[model samples]
Target: MSNSVPMTVEGHRRLQEELKTLIRVERPKVVQDIAEARSHGDLSENAEYDAAKERQGFVEGRIQELNDKIARAQVIDPATIKSDKIVFGATVTVFDVDTEKEATYQIVGEDEADIKHGKISITSPVGKALIGHQVDEEVRIVVPSGVRVYEITRISYT
Candidate 1:
């Protein structure tokens, strides 16, 4: 219920790295490109200037977004949290009730949710359903594909 965003320590580190790279490397490069493009004259006819301006806009927007997320982040270390029931930063293994397939996912922040990497956002449908659930409990999640039931097989803090 907190307004602060929950993110794993690794996710926070990654965001810090990206912010550093953008401010130290990309920002200056974009500024130089803009200046060089402007020197070519006729701003309306300059494609390089237009492209550079567009890239600058995107870069600035991303920088602001990263800064906000980092500032509001509540870094959670999974290894430090101990819980038998599923919670933020918990890694849960689930068995599909229909297909009988098993899958593992780590409940993470919105920015760290990469399904291919087995990380899901706590705000996600499945993540929300799994929260506070215990091992062997069945969870019903309504996803875009439709409703699916999963049985919690295991829960771990790390």
Candidate 2:
């Protein structure tokens, strides 16, 4: 579909796993809780029933969201990519011109962005600036902290 979302293979796998857990485990647990709460006499003053129903709604919504994400996911494998310039699924090392520090980051889809692991969303400012640029190219991007310049030192697909 035209509304497809790009994501790494690992991101897709994680979503699938969460969907499985919600359907196979959480769904049944919530159903049991509702049943037990219903057996406790009057439902008018049953706080447990209300809570269980709320949780069930949340779980069901999450499951549907995960399913939609998985269905629209365009999984891109980094290992199969080959290019001299930066693009989605490329791991790049850049030297900060102002700080004089080097950092590595992988340009990934929005769903796969994890800054803690050095993975950045392709739609992010830095990632967008790096795209289509070759090694040793200086890229200047305006971020929240003002303009920052970086020199691309390396690019790898794997």
Candidate 3:
């Protein structure tokens, strides 16, 4: 069985915007660049032509990838998600048992996860460990630093 491609509504909108920009703006610009480069003659010796072709290929590939992802995306709004248990789109506050440090992270999709922003992908080790757990539950997750225990202090949708 294949896993669902879970994504927040915002993340999905971002992807859609990116796809639109690539198709409407970037694609046309690259095509124009290629045409202008071709006018220089001698395609084999033209550096601009080569660069433009490479860039065009890259843009097309990215567009295809984004389209595929959007097609399979399961957009979920955080505010609409209601559950006491930890799940995707849940903002969970965890207290480190060993370090006595508290940290909050929003469980997000792979495309939207930014560690610097305290957003973690649902597929991550800690996220996986927290899933299906409720507030006050102690979870032990195996990380590169070794096994660490964290108590879920709070869970919020927003």
- The weakest ten consecutive residues by lDDT in model 3 span 1-10
Instruction: Give me the displacement of residue 15 in model 3, in angstroms.
Output: 0.2
Give the distance in Å from residue 110's predicted Cα in candidate 1 to where it truly belongs.
Answer: 0.3
Off by over 4 Å in 1: none
Ranking of all predicted structures according to lDDT, beginning with the best and ending with the worst: 1, 3, 2
Write one digit per residue (lDDT tens) for candidate 1, span 1-158. Answer: 33798999999999999999999999999999999999999999999999999999999999999999999999999999888989899999999999999999999999999999999999999999999999989999999999999999999987
Could you arrange the candidates by TM-score from highest to lowest?
1, 3, 2
Candidate 2's C-alpha runs over 4 A off are none
Q: Quick one: best TM-score, which candidate?
A: 1
TM-scores of the models, in the order given:
0.96, 0.92, 0.95
Question: Which runs of model 3 end up more than 4 angstroms from their true locations?
Answer: 1-3
- Per-residue alpha-carbon lDDT of candidate 2 for residues 28-141, written as tens digits (9 for 90 to 100): 999999999999989999999999999999999999888888888889998898889887899999999999999999998887799999999999999899999999999999
Q: Candidate 1 at 141: error in angstroms? A: 1.2
